[model samples]
Target: MALGWKLVVDAGDPHRQAAFWAEALGYQIEDNSTLIERLLAAGTVEQSLCVEFQGRLFWRDAAAVRHPDDPFDPVSGTGLGRRLLFNRVPEPKAGKNRLHVDVHADRGQRDATVARLRAHGATLVRHVKEPGGEWSVLTDPEGNEFCVS
Candidate 1:
């Protein structure tokens, strides 16, 4: 049998990271507020565990984004398919990411993609041109490194 998984990333601000990745990947931010409201109303979850952003409630320390076409639990808005979860951490990113996402672009779209990402708060670390091909290395707003090729 095979196992399923979701990628999890540590962040200083999970909500912000969710928004960034959602836009970057054309994904939707998961909306778990319906379940949260029910839990809060039933006194199953404390108010302190939730935070309101843009008038929507979310788990205080975590947020997630999901592929738009993926199946998900409607009531909880939890993705059942490909997803990325971001959780808050007290410490900042210390070094390079051991695993990083690579954004693939069409054959000639690399520069335009890099420019768009830069406008969206990605910092260009450098451009690499090896025997394989070229790619632009970038760091997300919170300093997690990724690449565009």
Candidate 2:
């Protein structure tokens, strides 16, 4: 049987991380209005724990971004497959990341992509030329690392 998966990331601010990664990957951030409403009505979550996301309600501490063509359930406003979930954490990042995303840019667009990401609060950590090719290592606004090639 075919299985589905999501890339889950831990961060201090999932909403911010989701926004940054959505823009970086050209993906759409998921809307969790149904979940939010249910939680609010059940008193499982406080209003302060929610945020207005893209003009809709979502959990303030977590967000999911997905490929545009991926399957999703509109009734729950949840992505059914192929998504990236960013969840909040209390501790600060202390060491290197065990996993990171790599972005592929067309030739001559690499530099421009790097600049654009920097404009969006990403920091350029360094550049590397590996046997495969050249790429830039960058960190998001909250310091999660990703590579652009």
Most accurate candidate by TM-score: 1
Cα lDDT for residue 40, candidate 2: 93
Q: Which stretches of candidate 1 lie over 4 Å from their true place?
A: none
**Per-model TM against the reference:** 0.95, 0.88
Give the per-residue lDDT of model 2 (tens digit) for 29-133. Answer: 998888789989999989998988678898888899998898898877788877899998999888889999998988789999999899988999999998988
Best by lDDT: 1
Give the lowest summed-lDDT range of ten residues in model 2.
Answer: 74-83
- C-alpha lDDT values of all predictions: 0.93, 0.89
The 10-residue segment of model 1 with minimum total lDDT is 17-26
Off by over 4 Å in 2: 38-48
TM-score of 2: 0.88
- Candidate 1 yields a Cα-based lDDT of 0.93
lDDT of 2: 0.89
* Per-residue error (Å), model 1, residue 36: 0.8
Candidate 2 colliding pairs: none
